[model samples]
Target: MAKKKSNVVNLDERKEAKAKASSGNSMMVSIMNMTKRIEELKTEKQKICEMAARTILKALDAKDKYTYGHSMRVTYFSMVLGKELGLNDQEMYDLQLSALFHDIGKIGTPDAVLNKPTRLSDEEFKIMKKHPTESYEILKGFSVFEKVARFAKHHHERYDGRGYPDGLKGEQIPLYSRIILIADTFDAMTSTRVYRKGLPYQTAYDELNEFSGSQFDPELVVKFIRGMKKEQAKKEDKFYIPLMDEMYEKDAA
Candidate 1:
């Protein structure tokens, strides 16, 4: 009877140990599954955000063809400076999106103010100046676009404390914003319009240099000019924008 009882106790101990090992293995598998699921969710969220960005860009295209093309050019120009600045991959990505969306708020402006061929009146200029704030409003709602929104909002700020909508000065402005502003002004000066011929690249460079430290960041202006000179030397007829999957001629009008 004693021997039989001991055998029963040993069997119970073995069964308990096996059960514990099985529970531990199950827990490990659950943890691994959760980790994989988390990674997948992150990828899915990124895709959704990208999709949203594309949709908004398309809407801008439909609203203003000129602005759409300008956005593409601005993005290209910003990337040139971004490369010269030795930005990391993620910084480059963020810079591209911020530049592309910087003028997106113009979509909400009245056509008279937005599409006027002549110089704007004070009222019209006031309306036009609201675009950066409008851009912030449009973009700040998205979790993925929070940083991009801030960059867009501050793109109009000057190196001096003279700019509008908050007047953030010098390095107080986001670096990406400062970079985009240079690119924006460059594109505006160099892009051909019905009323005026585009300035030569050198002429535009001179203009940027003239305003350095007053209207623009002095260091960034130098880097932008250097980078752009290299781009011009490439002598490539067409440049491709990866975000929109489109190609633009080097001197697109």
Candidate 2:
């Protein structure tokens, strides 16, 4: 409590000092100081925003561990493709958030539907399809994730416009959504589950290639495959997640 009060008092003093500095050189220095302080505040705000993001992800993790791990791998794969496509730093950051939250809506799904070992029935599939929109609903509430929510909401939309929620066609879907779908599908295909073994990387790549122009974005699919080949060359069994500040194992874990 005392430290908090002291910080408030220090901020008041700085404001007062700025108001008092009227001389040309003093005013310039005050302006510079204010700019630096503004930058610091922005950094602090971003950290807080990231904390909120991590907290929400923890909720998702607690609800279902498999989904949480899947989300992480999706983010890593999306980032690999993001790099291959030459995404700028800011673009990559937004893509990461989009991938992490893409399946967040699944938390609202029934446990039976989420954890079923076999293929979903037509009725259960309908329930499963609601997740992307649910993801949008949850994430849109956060002011910082406005764009990310939109991206997540459309991650399942197909290139041929046969997907759900909005039925958006090619180039109509957000680019991050396109990139995320590729990653999401890749992880789903390659991640091991209780009912069956995960497909080999080469098999997954072939599936991706076969569906490139229909389910996945044609160009991004190519870039993702190229980037994944480089990832395989590294032979690293783990990948890093920036938001969680932790390392996670690759597929078949």
Candidate 3:
């Protein structure tokens, strides 16, 4: 066989390899910059969606006084109480969303029943009771908030299986639902409806105490009580009574 020429370079090939390595490093830098830019855009998109969602909620608030501020107060209480109970951030987020939507089913209720200055008739109340299920149906379609759907649907359930849409008793109820239930009841009791007056904080606390084990989770109630005590000690945490009264008075007027 005839000798073939060795076309491969020695030092020249090493220099070319070094050049390629530096080019690859530049390409990697470019890729990182692009990745960061994409993340920023994604973050901006999330902010926009969040703003839009809040705007929708605000619009809903304007249409319904009973719903508007009540939802926000429940959300704040639920989230703070959940955090005090040592729930994780994601769980707390779900609790807030659930609390905010717990009364959404009432949107399906007629204004006569929902905004009635007098006590609801049995039939009207029965129709009003369907709100939780209505809320669940409305929210379940949003797969992103499926967890919240359960919370809204079951918040009305009683610890002793007395409360409603479903008769789930005791531990059968989801903890998140149970949490919102406590918050919802607390806010509802402290807030005057068209047919009733707001209870004093002491009265509300006593009511919650009286209802424990039957109406609420005893352990959660204990945590709630402790949280309330701590909150009451803070100057900014004193909104439970005044805020409810003012809002409800406005509603009544």
Candidate 4:
């Protein structure tokens, strides 16, 4: 009888040990599954954001073809400057989106004012200047675009505090905004149109230098000129914009 009782007790101890081990394994599997699910959700969110961005670009394309192309070129130019500044991957991504959408508010501008070949009158210019704020209004509602929207809204701000809208100045201006401003102005000066020939690269560089510290950030202007000169030396006809996932020829600009 004593031997039989000892045998029963050993069996119970073995069974309890096995049960504890099984429960631990099950808990580990659950934890791994939860981690994988979290990664999948993050990927899904990023895809949704990219889809929304493409849709907005399509709308801008329908509204104005020239502005659409201009936005693309601005994005490319901004990336070049971002590289010169040694920005990280995430920083470059944000700057690219900000530049691409900087003039998105122009979609709401009157066609007459947007396409006018000549200079805008004071009143028309006032309406045109409202585009930055309009960009903010359109983008502020989207949580994913919070920073990009703010950068676009302040792209027109001058370094000397004389610019329109919020009038943010100098270092107070967002760094990405300052970079976009340089790219925007460069594209505008260098892009050829039916009415006027694009300025020579040197001429454009000189203009940027002349207005530095007032209309533009002086350090950025220097960096831009240096980077662009190197880019020109490369003489690469084709350029790729990562955000758009497309390649464009320099001549197309």
TM-score of each: 0.88, 0.86, 0.74, 0.86
Worst 10 residues of 1 by lDDT: 243-252
Pairs with backbone N, CA or C atoms under 3 Å apart (clashes), candidate 4: none
Q: Summarize candidate 1's per-residue lDDT along 49-135 as a digit string, tens digits.
A: 778867877888888778988888999999999999999999999999899999988878998888899999999999999999998
Clashing pairs in 2: none
Please estimate how well model 2 matches the true structure, expressed as its whole-model Cα lDDT.
0.91
Model 3 clashing residue pairs (backbone): none
Please give the ranking of all candidate structures by lDDT, highest first, separated by commas. Answer: 2, 1, 4, 3
Q: Write the per-residue lDDT of candidate 4 for residues 1-253, one digit (tens) a residue.
A: 9999999999999999999999999999999999999989876876687677678777888987778888888888898899999999999988988898889888789999998999999999999999999888777666778999999999999999998788888999999999999999988998887788888889999999999999999999999898888899998987888878898766433
Off by over 4 Å in 2: 1-35
Model 1 Cα shift for residue 143 (angstroms): 1.0
CA deviation > 4 Å runs, candidate 1? 1-29
Quote the positional error of residue 48 for candidate 4 in Å: 2.1
User: Which candidate tops TM-score?
Assistant: 1
lDDT of 4: 0.88
RMSD of 1: 3.0
Which digits, one per residue and each the tens of the lDDT, describe model 3 over residues 1-253? Answer: 1223333454577889999999999999999999999999876764564454455556667668777777767776776688788988767766767887777767667777877777788999899899889878877766555787888899889999998988999999999889888888888788876667887667878898999999999999888878877776774633432212332221222
Off by over 4 Å in 4: 1-36
Tell me the number of clashing residue pairs for each predicted model: 0, 0, 0, 0
